[model samples]
Target: MSSQWSQGEIYESYVGRWSRLVAAEFVAWLDQPAGLRWLDVGCGTGALTTAVLTQAEPSAVVGVDPSEGFVGFARGAVADERARFEVLPAAELSTDAVGGAVDVVVAGLVLNFIPDRPDALRRMREIGRTVGVYVWDYAEGMQLMRYFWEAAADVVPDDRERDEGRTFPFCNPAGLEGLFAEAGFSDIETRAIVVPTVFESFDAYWTPFLGGQGPGPAYLRSLHPNTQTAIRHLVESRLPANPDGSIELTARAWAARGTS
Candidate 1:
């Protein structure tokens, strides 16, 4: 629940891979025509922005994120002349900075982290000629955090405080749709995209959290090292015992699209 998104290595290590998978799914939702211009809000590491460029082949692509390290990583990863990266928050996007109307605006797994979600959505709408947004958060009852917490609870059963991490911002599909509607997006449609988060072993599963990238990382960091280790062991033990031995985490993300 820290507002700061300064953990660059953590983000790329823990969440960035899965985030890229979700971004690819989000791009599939777009009816991206040739020569479309795209603005990627909160384009962490430029994964989604790169996806947009690959899929849409837009006339120009601009990616913005609040984290300098993430923006820097994105700049280095994506070297297309038409693609640009900036260290700016989504809430600051305006018609003035963008020059003229943008053909499309895309946000990937970003809305939940922004403090002023409504205003940010509105700004995206204002700047976009057409808006397509994708958000992936811990779905209620199906959260990956639940796996960690179920194990952590054994160690710290009294800590009801840790639950708030699971409940942060866009934890449900209805909430996501409502935010879009409130922001004046019309013809909003939402659907669930399920991805299997497979890990080779407990170390593969738990190392990412130690990096402290997103909510899971944050929660892991809050614990003592002993408690963190215990939680990891517990989660590994609870994994469905497959002969192939890959831990499969069912991750659900909500994607919404509408006209500005």
Candidate 2:
């Protein structure tokens, strides 16, 4: 099934919180000097843009996303003089939008969703001296989604075809590196940024899937109500919850960067 990208609040409940953690680590990893112009391609509610403003001290940051709802949410959520939100797609991003060539450009947890990643990366390379991106290691290290999809396959084997792990094979280091290299970037590098994803209870975790904001959740919504409950129960049973019933999982994102 095609993924849903609108509905900022629902998407935030699903993965935006986790993406914020990855974005901070990702910005720190880039280690760019302060006072530079930055572009956040597929900014998605300003997670990475906020990180850049708070961590990197960029002079200015323009966040661009295809979803008007996401851009609106970002504008309201990130109220910084240095930050601006635009309703634009990654494929259409240009230096003009960011007010000339930017010093750094980054995409957080969004490369996998772009239909033409190579072209997008090429465009990113053109707009910034340094370009970086991070995507969830959905195939393995992103434990939360891994658990959900594993349980899903057990209940409905055909659903395995819809798993992000299977769908986003290029999210890994080698694949990311290849994309950067092909985009004519130099000194390419990649690393994993794993963070804690703690839910107060199974309800906190299960409820987000019901919001139907992304692929996994959208897929879950497609099933019969009974099947959805079965998947939820199977995932809950498998989770190693704490004595207080909190569920702790780690999300790992593969981050890559290169110089233009």
Candidate 3:
């Protein structure tokens, strides 16, 4: 089944909060100076774009995504005139309305979702002097999603196909570095950004799945009620929860950067 992105609030309830934490760290790692123009490719809900505005003091931030609802949500969420959101795909971004090129371009947690990823990188290179991206290490580093998918795969054999770890091999360091090299980028580098993914209760961890935004949650909602409960039980049984009903774990995102 395909994923729908019209429900911005629901997505924020699930992944956007954690994405913001990673965005801050991603920008900090960039360590660029203030007043540089920034392009945020696949800027879902403006999490990374807002992080750059809040953390980097960029002269302007242009965010591009294919979903109108996401662009609208980001436009309303961040009112700074220095930031702008567009309902366009990463591969189609051009010079901004001011006819200006960006100093840096980055994608946060969105590269794996773009269909024509190599084309997207080439297009990003056209808009900036430096390009970079970061994605959740869904295979083993993002403990929250790893638990959900592992539990789902155990209960539903077919659900393994929908696991992002299986679908998006490009999320890893070697895979990303290969992409940059193929795209003709120089001075390439890759690193990891770690963020905490803690849930206060089983409900806190499971209720977000009902939002049905991403692939895992979409697959969860597609199941029969009893099957869904079984998967939920399986996830709960595997989590490392404490006496206070909190589940604390780390999420690692692999980030890559290179010069155009």
Candidate 4:
């Protein structure tokens, strides 16, 4: 049980906000036909599931997550009978649960977190005729969190190596496309999706880190309160702010899709 799968609301506050922005672009690039059956692996709050429903006409959608809290929230929030949520692991998906395979399978902000991505991707391919994935380009393309880590390095030089950006190098296109290839997918296509993450104030931007939703926020929780404050100060000192006290930043995610 990692904190990453703990609370859906806390995660929505941290990265879900930006994931929604990316989901639209991610589904747009999916470019699949309407009336397709979709399986949203690691759906997490139904952001991607909602994106698919909103952007395209899907006959049915099944969302799976190991987190019960997330599944519960998704079931309650997404009102369509066409969309359903289940507490299931990516590695354990089967034809029975997915209704004998879907037309397309998509995972959002999830690939980098899978313990065994090759196995998970293979399962995804098994559950759908098309398999796809997208993750925040934490290594380079996701600038907002990267900037936070950049400031963090100044405050706690000793902990710089553990930053999310440094640790998740597979967030890039090459890594993702390669995973799809390894999973026996063909016609693979990968693209970068960039979106803006704006905050009304610095506090608005930084408070999510206190939610303990992901590794970065979990790392923040590990530090002493004084150290956390120092990191916050460093981050604020480094960020460029607008006159109205708002901060506008961009986050990019690498997406890849292919047929099996």
Best model per TM-score? 2
State model 1's lDDT: 0.76
Inter-residue clash pairs, candidate 2: none
**What clash pairs does model 4 have?**
none
Worst 10 residues of 4 by lDDT: 1-10
Clashes of each: 0, 0, 0, 0
Alpha carbon deviation, residue 231, candidate 2 (Å): 0.5
Ranking by lDDT: 2, 3, 4, 1
Candidate 2: where is the Cα deviation over 4 Å? 1-3
Once model 2 is optimally superposed onto the true structure by TM-score, how far is the C-alpha of residue 238 displaced, in angstroms?
A: 0.2
157-206: candidate 3 lDDT, tens digit per residue:
86678888999888898999998887778899999999998889989988
**What local distance difference test score does each model get?**
0.76, 0.90, 0.87, 0.86
Clashing pairs in 1: none
- Candidate 2 lDDT, tens digit per residue, 11-82? 889999999999989999999999999999988888999999999988999998989989899999998999
- In candidate 1 the C-alpha lDDT for residue 63 amounts to 87
- lDDT winner: 2
Give one digit per residue, the lDDT tens place, for model 1 in 83-160: 998878876799777656788998877877788888988999999877766666553534566677677778778764
Structure candidate 3, residue pairs in collision: none
Task: Give the per-residue Cα lDDT of candidate 1 at 66.
Answer: 81
